[model samples]
Target: MSSTFSLKYMSRRVSCAFNLLQVCLVVAVLALLVTASPLFAENALNGAENTAEAETEAGVAAAEVIQAPALAAIAPAPAADEPLSPRMRAALGYVAQRYRVSADALRPIFHAVQSTSQELSLDPLLIVAVIGVESRFNPFSQSVMGAQGLMQVIPRFHKDKLPANAGKAPLLDPVTNVRVGSLALEEAIRRNGGLMEGLQQFAGATRDEDQTYATKVLSEKQRLEDAANRRLGRG
Candidate 1:
């Protein structure tokens, strides 16, 4: 009986040891699975973060490219035409106001001056200066010396140079005055060689000192230009 009891006790001790060993092995395997799961989760999160960063950078690049073309399209273009002449533009305004007419009313006179000046190879400003001085753009102005129209043309001179009945009509008619004045100015320019000498020639015998007449006419031209600038609010 004692021997049988010892054998049974030994067998029971062996069975308990084996069960404990099995529990320890299962615990070790569960610990390994938990640690490896965390590593895999961290790697997946890092990959997702990298992908999101790349997408954000791509969006910023796309925005820059889109805005580049849009900004270029909206940019202002440069002006491509010539600017107007201040002197000529101011002269036109003066002519409009002094004549009490619209700018269009003097288009013919402007064209005549331009055409005649070109044909005579004269400065249009010189012609305008003479017109401003002689009559203040008044077509019918007559001098005490019987000089008629804007040019203060002498009737006898017109008879010699112009067609018949040239001086019989009203002296202040703008078209007739411009025609006669242009012709006389052309003749004066021919005799004098250039604008300066022609101006001197036009002033001859008109004043006690020849330079005095030229000075007066030039001064008048300046006044007209000033008046025009004032009206245009450029003064």
Candidate 2:
């Protein structure tokens, strides 16, 4: 039997066995990072009004994506007509506030995730969570393991999967990075036969029996869910 280990939405599932306490710890660290930079809150507030319009345009700005495969899908993407759902909007806001980036600037990233969701059956929140765990939203981040861009994908391992026209340093491009990373994530889950193992493979930590990397990714995802629910009055 093939192990179908997709990282489905945690809010609705009884699987994965994610540790909420660990999630809370990550959130606390995130909070401390924001607190250390008070201007982040101020910047988020100042950019609030612009978010609506920018987000509208941002949805239109998200480039196209190619699919490697869908990992049994994740969070439901809102209706095609309403790409930016309340949950998605809430997620964008939280990321902007936490990362000290303007909401207007994050619109494109959300849009990209949304677009990818439509194709690859992954949730924007999950992708957002992975990005946080991988690189804290830093498009230029490069791990000591040779992972690069916001998704921390190792280019050498996935150059063939990249867009043909993507020039040198393609992984550094946020849009391209997200697209390839999502595909890579799907492939990993599909190959590993389950979410836990897939995430372990993605993190290059298959031997970690405690599943720390998967736990961290899920924790970040839970945080996104909480933020979305709170913003949507569904908490």
- Give candidate 2 regions above 4 Å deviation: 1-82
- Find the 10 residues in a row with the least total lDDT in model 2: 63-72
Q: Pick the candidate with the highest lDDT.
A: 2
Q: What number of backbone clashes does candidate 1 have, counting pairs of residues 3 or more apart or in separate chains? A: 3
Specify the highest-TM-score model's number.
Answer: 2
Please report, in order, the local distance difference test score of every candidate based on alpha carbons: 0.70, 0.82
Candidate 1 residue lDDT tens string, 79-183: 224333565667777777766757665555566566666677766666777877777666667788888766777766655556565545634555556666777
TM-score (C-alpha) between model 2 and the true structure: 0.64
lDDT of 2 by residue, 1-235 (tens): 2334433454336433456667888999999997877787777876885897798777665531222134225323333344686788999888888888777656667777888867888877889999988988888999888899989999989987899798979998777888899999888998999988988998889999999999999999999999888888899
Give the runs in model 1 whose Cα sits over 4 Å from its true position. 1-90, 98-102, 164-167, 170-172, 206-210, 220-235
My TM-score estimates for the predictions, one after another, are 0.49, 0.64
